[model samples]
Target: MNKKRMLVSLVTGAILGVFCIVGASIRSGGEASTSLLFALWYNRIIMGLVIGLNISKKDLPSIIIRGAFLGLVVSFAYYASTGFTDIVSFLAGIIYGIIIEYVNFRVNK
Candidate 1:
């Protein structure tokens, strides 16, 4: 990806991470959350959407498959960087990407 797109992906991921942190804080009765799983879940969806923007309609399906894989890899790396080891975090990232895409399609349709 180009620098601009990479920047967008990074920023989007940061925004999503902020939301997940906020969500976790609320879920934890306003206590701050220092959870890597939440961060992984957020980054993957944002990365998927970033990659999706570069895919054409004819290649969308295959591209999405690759995008999901990339998303998982990115999330896993972030998790490792943050000292996370749960495999569930990677799975959650994949599920979140599919769910988010499905919801976006449903709404736009």
Candidate 2:
């Protein structure tokens, strides 16, 4: 339970969540529903929190895999909620997961 790692991850998630919202709006021609925007933002935050709390191998490979796995799992909730229609977002979740973990690793190094 490294507080620094947790805080970093949470901040990363929050930042990335904003990006997700912006991307969603652009993709939807600024017509994306409010709920959808909030969900995307919230999902990243949850992903960050989960990744922050998870204790994975120190190696980069392990971190990447763990991040991707956690991303897929956490993103699946939103994907399923959308009836599995938003494949891009689901995939982005995996990438964001990797990014989050990599950032954590580098920053804490």
Candidate 3:
């Protein structure tokens, strides 16, 4: 695995995780449970790890697809855990995945 890619992805995850928390708080009007918030944050972290560890084709198209796929798969866990009620977050996960991979590609290139 590429350490640079991993590091970039992880950092991206951590940053996005914070954003996820903020978004959740706003969406729930600060009424979201702590556990739910934590899960949402951790979900992004896991997504990052998965994306970072993924050793796939280096081309841009391949990277974007892989990122989207990984994000969708990883985010599904959290989405499923919530009984599929948070469609917004589930969709955001796919976007975040693409962002993470695109950032990694740019930074590591």
Candidate 4:
């Protein structure tokens, strides 16, 4: 594994995670519960990190597949822990995964 690539992924994931939490906080007008807020941040960070760690190429289809899978896994875990599931979270994770992979592609290119 490329250490530089992994580093890039880590930073990218962290930034994306922060943005996800911030956006949610804004959208909810700070009304979101502590548990929900934590969950959102946790999900995004883990998803981003996973994508960054695993994504090794620039192929769109591959990126989409990996992202979708990672998102599903994370979302499922959250559901198992909280007994809550939502399509939005699953979709968001996939989207974030794609974006992270694309960014990595661009950077590495």
Estimate, for each residue in 1-109, the C-alpha lDDT of model 3 and write its tens digit: 9898888899999899999999999999999999999999999999999999977456999988988999999999999999999999999999999999999888877
**Model 1: residues with Cα > 4 Å off, grouped in runs:** 34-58, 77-92, 95-109
Q: Give the alpha carbon lDDT tens digit for every residue of 1-109 in model 2.
A: 9888888899999999999999989988999999999999999999999999987457999999998999999999999998999888899999999999999999898
Which candidate would rank higher by TM-score, 2 or 4? 2
Off by over 4 Å in 3: none
| Candidate 4 residue-pair clash tally | 0
> What's the number of clashes in each of the models?
0, 0, 0, 0
Worst 10 residues of 3 by lDDT: 54-63
Model 1 weakest 10-residue run by lDDT:
100-109
- Model 4, 1-109: lDDT tens digits are 7666677766776777677777767777888678887887777777666766673866778766776677677666655654564445556666676676777777887
Query: Candidate 2: RMSD over Cα atoms?
Result: 0.9
Q: On a 0 to 100 scale, what is the lDDT of residue 78 in model 1?
A: 58
Full candidate order by lDDT, most accurate first: 3, 2, 4, 1
- Estimate, for each residue in 24-106, the C-alpha lDDT of model 1 and write its tens digit: 56655775445543654456546645554552323346545754665676666655765675445556555444444433333
Q: State every prediction's TM-score relative to the real structure.
A: 0.48, 0.96, 0.95, 0.75
